[model samples]
Target: MSDWTPAEMPRLDDATVVVTGANSGLGYEGTREFARRGATVVMACRSVERAETAAAELRESTSATLELDVRECDLASLDSVETFADGLAADYDGVDVLCNNAGVMAIPRGETEDGFETQFGVNHLGHFALTGRLFPLLVAADGIDGDARVVTQSSGAHETGEMDFSDLNWERSYGKWKAYGRSKLANLLFAYELQRRLDAADDDLGVRSVACHPGYADTNLQLRTAAESGNPLLKLGMRAANAVLGQDAATGAEPMLYAATADVDGGAYVEPGGLMNMRGHPTVGRSNDASYDRDDARRLWEYSTEATSVEFPL
Candidate 1:
């Protein structure tokens, strides 16, 4: 449906949903709706204090009986991801949805705790390791209700992304935006490849891997990037552009909600359906040609497993 909204989101009662970056932006918006709809939302965030504040607000605003689990999960650190997964596994037998929604945008060139490019590490490899570590819980959820979903949040910037396997860390040279794009591209590759692996496996696990992007959403990411760049003019220009062209974070979260809950097939790419797929209701869409490259996906998967020291159960 072209005009889908969160109000129409199906009841997620009796589900356990994990959302990374749940402290703010699109993750916060999605968490609100999920909690309102009775799903136990795990707020996996970088800051426990901020997440606790967000959980309090979400509880007060949504339902008195809303269930929220705030956990510390810093995507920049592999050990943190593992710890988060271990905690989830210890408490929950299965998880119905895992939203790989945490990411860093066009920030200055930096390295994650694992010594990888910040964007590539946080945006792609972090999620890769998290997904693999949580694979058992997802598989155990196979017959709990219906297909469990892994909703990965990418970006339109992925269209311009190019994978340079030779130097994914950007050691020789660094372009912040380029690295961001490449990381987003890797998100799509991982989403599609996960679906393919699931389908080809001996057992039908009923875990759908769908990717979606929030087009031009007015979130703090742009502001933070501009502020971190130490460019006043860029900050002013970005503020103006966001005010003019960006949609609110809640509106931008529709595609992710749709991909996570709608009757979409595995590997579907959900995005906004307005002018140039920028801002509107959620709709199934297509990504770029390069994103569908199987060779690159395979290479990325291999390198990611080696880098993160995590393996998919496929």
Candidate 2:
């Protein structure tokens, strides 16, 4: 656990990693780095065609030693998540890293395939269920500095989140931006709570659940959200903002990459080491006060278990 940055990240010669939304944006950037460092990356994406195209593009630019495999796993569908987890467990020896990087932003209010709110369902519960389903593998992964890592990518937007347990599905009212905030906050809560459980578990398995946020870097997330939001102004504004103020997507992936490979402890929050956490190299940072509320985390965990029907290995 020495002081290290993304440039000092250790290579993963024989590690196997699973990254959702690996077809583009932060997920792809992280996957590219992992693959470049000689890890076998399983690209979990919703569309096989897009995943293949992205993988091929990476292969073209990446070192020939890199290995990338694409698999279909749509977070909006619990059934699909279950199938993906089952397939991963059967095919891989153990997962060294599980990057819950796939998520939607402030898109239009909608429901997932399972009738849950789109943001909460895909961004939080989907990853929640996926992580729970893969808990055994994470526990069994071969340890380098410690055990396997469950790196959940959260966001600064969490500062604005207030988890509304009563109307999680947004049956009463739906606010796209607020829902996005809630999802990011849930990512932090789940990561911290999972770490607590891991620390308390009696088993020798020493898995770590860590959280990280790429401070605002330019990614297609904003554009996608705006496009789907059906707000012409939002779409124009985001595109303009990204063009003018955003950093590169690869740079945006630095914090997450550091979190995945650094000598960090469970519950650590990695943020860009720069002014206002907007952009810079990956380094440790602070989360908002609401993120540390244990009572709320517990309640959220319970509700997540009931909602997803996938309980953690507590």
Candidate 3:
């Protein structure tokens, strides 16, 4: 498949886009690009101050004819996700694009504010709850617009993951990277299953679920995870690696932007088109066989719904 570049993206003037974890890194860069293309950009971030600062920077730099709204939402907490969804539903009649972009990686095993494993809670369940709660607004947007898109961020590390239902929370043994891999794998499975449900229901809600990965981009998430693990050597190595092969966060955002706006089929998984999925341009990539298992996807969907207590109308 041919790779996609930021310059090739379609004009997003009429789209109302929400990007979770929009304070920095790929999320912030994605927000900037959408705003630059004239989409009303909502920065849903855990840090209100940081999000506001980033929004202000975008406003100062771009002459794009779109407004930016920064809202606070901590994906690690279901209550916070609910509040954010509630506020969005109350304030806006519709949302055209929902980008589940914020995520944590390789952090020390720990609990969230809600006492769930941090990786699963924030990376999968949180977005699951948020998307479920916001489905109505998404449908509303589809009623007005021709299409509405939901983009979930997965990772290449998903290839190394296997879901352990018996120890989903890493209760028996918590390995930082493994848990993170499981969470990311869950992301791809969720996207695939969601699209399948939408198709089966023949829903014309104009909502399609897609997944993308920002292949080895230089982002603050890596630094934060390394700091949490107290691994200076790993951090140093990552920094050096990034300096050599990592692309800018703007480049990293290309796959997501393409998935959200490009004329692509539903259920496509996008990633950077470079050597070994490191960094470059955006293209449709292959998902692991495990990620495409219908049985596993359904089981995970059921488990996630039970865990997050958010019911989908499917």
Candidate 4:
């Protein structure tokens, strides 16, 4: 990790940062830190009530010198994703940073509202569609101190995943962790591809896509998954890991915070700088070798466009 801490983060007095899943965990931590640095924050979440409560708590704890708006957005629903995009476009000409941080972890097999496998749909397609819908505004926005960024949250699990397009929805078989890995891998591929397209676009657009991972954070994400998975052994194992190996959510949020706010190139992957990357400070990182496959990324992009029906204006 770099020597950069939240205290050294750049001020964003005129910036707007949109964070999905802002109701809890790293999303909430990122929102709080961004707001603390004077950025107008849009807390996009699945539940409005939870979002409102989180916003209130954020306000109470942090001395924000800017604004915060909590908007409802269910990533599993295409309608909700479009609605959230429409609302943001109507309210703001553009936003400085878009943090695609909302996602599902290892959980029981399920389907999204649009019938996509739960993990692939919410973790990959949801953000893909959201970014496509919001691209115009992203291209229009002036990055607070550098270039506008679409910071997608990826994970270490991606190292073990591959783009099984034939089984993209995991219809024939399923493993929660494998599904989770596939989604994270897709996240990296999408970020890299988006950055490639932006790099080829008009320089005036001043937009780029980057990615990061939170490392092993003891957030409700895992606990929730285990509880809902109906597997006592899985639940117990996860609980044990949380108690012994997990870092606090705030520490885990550092890499993402750095990736979103620091002056960095598109396609860069930020991760925790410590032993096995489980806990440490923010640092410039790299994804697995598979994540760098241009052909895979392009194919995934095309398929995602077809899947989500939201095309980028590149």
Candidate 5:
């Protein structure tokens, strides 16, 4: 089959989508696209003001005939995630699509509110707990809507990741990039393992799990990282390289939009089509062998359950 594009997405009338980090970057663009397709998009962001601003901008730009709801969710804190999920559950009986797209790139060594390494905690475990908490609503939605999807945002950096469970918190040593890679890898593994559990459950719940990576995209994430590090030279180099190679956030969101709404089978890992899966249109991409290790995935799931105290019913 040919590669999927944003235009291929089905009309999303009556659909309810919750997107983490919908206030900016690819997540914001994805929210706009979904709203343009008639889906009621919920912006689960850390900042309510930013979320409202983004929703206003989207409303002005599109005439897709859908409403937007903006809410607060700081994934770094489990309490915040719980409050966000609880609020969503109280407001909506079901959710058609959940896009776990919020994440931090390389940042200076720091711990999350929960005392875990910042990147891994926010990028992986945060979404993991969020999904688990919202799963009941998702299952209910699938029962009512016929199908539901959960799309986790991973990255190309996962190829270089190794799950150092012994040092997941980086108590002994810390490298920002490596921790980010590990968290992204955790995302992929979590997606696959979630699919497995869902399939094994054999319930009528038609909830499917998938993963996607935005290739080199021009977004605030890169700029913020560089600014925080005070690396003007690296930032200049990135800008020069981006001019030559980086894709826009709209294009970067394609893989995620595809994974969220396409007719493709569950458990698929999607990415861009250009050189080294770095840029271009969306396509099915290869994940590293380590990412496919069922045993490790299961272990990670168990560890996450213990860490977050949120269990997947499957």
Candidate 6:
């Protein structure tokens, strides 16, 4: 799959893809490709109005028959996650793909509606609950010519992440980057554990849980972090770095698209195949050793299930 691009993706005429944070960045780029290739893409965003606006833009530019379903899903709130899943269940019989793409980068410490740290809550816990709630639908979609896939978007930062179960919420203190890394590490932990569980169940459920990362994409994620940090020098530095080293959203989204549609293995981590894993086409990249620790993943899973109350049917 060297130099693989969106042009290489297969047509998804009957697929249903739910992409969180679909209004911007890599999510938007992935949604555009899915819809253009004939999938019914659900734009799951925190703001319905903004999602509608992005949908409108996609419709005007994409295929006339593009089925872009706009839905509101605030990942910072557990109730919102349940509501979104409930609504989708009522309308769609199955989901071919679930793209856990919505996330927050390095930002000021805060709390979600559920009392968890903002980054961990939205980036890991929210997606954890959403995937658990949607497990039935994912199982139902299995064996329909192919398997249903869950693409959890992780990052290169996971290498530096250390799970602090004692202070999961950063109640004592918080380092923005550290918290972000932990959450991203949790993403991989959850993704791999889900696949392991599915295999152990052996119930013939063909739902593949994979992970991916966009290598230094020049998206609003960095800009928003810069603006939110409110440091002139930091903002200037981010802008200069983005201008010099970042790739476009389209290029950054290739790994996600590949993981979602290509013949990838379960628990595989897709990433850019360039030097330092920063800028290139989609490839099956590897995560740090900590990400593959079953003990940590199980502990995180138990804690998340207790916190979110969304149990997996596996």
Model 4 C-alpha lDDT per residue in residues 66-159, reported as the tens digit of each score: 4789999999999999999999999998888999999998888999999999999999999999999888888789985657889999999998
Residue-wise C-alpha lDDT for candidate 1, range 1-314, written one tens digit per residue: 48899888888788999999999999999999888888899999999999999888887875458889999999999999999999999999898999999899899999999899899999999999999999999988842248999999999999879999889999999999998999999999999999999999998887989999999999888998999899999999999999999999999988999998888999999999998999999999999988899999999999999999999989
* TM-score of each model, paired residue for residue: 0.98, 0.97, 0.96, 0.97, 0.96, 0.98
Candidate 1 regions with alpha-carbon error over 4 angstroms: 142-145
Minimum summed lDDT over a 10-residue window in model 1 is located at: 139-148
Q: What is the C-alpha RMSD of each candidate to the true structure, in Å?
A: 1.2, 1.8, 1.5, 1.3, 1.6, 1.2
lDDT at residue 228 of model 4 (Cα atoms)? 84
Which pairs clash inside model 3? Answer: none
Using TM-score as the measure, name the better of candidate 4 and candidate 6: 6
In model 4, which regions exceed 4 Å deviation? none
Global CA lDDT computed for model 4: 0.90
Roughly what TM-score does model 4 have, to 2 decimal places? 0.97
TM-score of candidate 6 relative to the true fold = 0.98
Candidate 5: list runs displaced more than 4 Å.
1-3, 143-145
lDDT of 6 by residue, 1-314 (tens): 46799998888888899999999999999999998888999999999999999888888885567899999999999999999999999999999999999999999999999899999999999999999988888888842248999999999999879998999999999999999999999999999999999889957687999999999999989988988899988888898998999999999999999999998899999999987898999899899999999999999999999999999988
| Candidate 2 structure quality by residue, lDDT tens digits, 225-306 | 8889788998899999998888889888888888889878889999887768877888887899899889889999999899
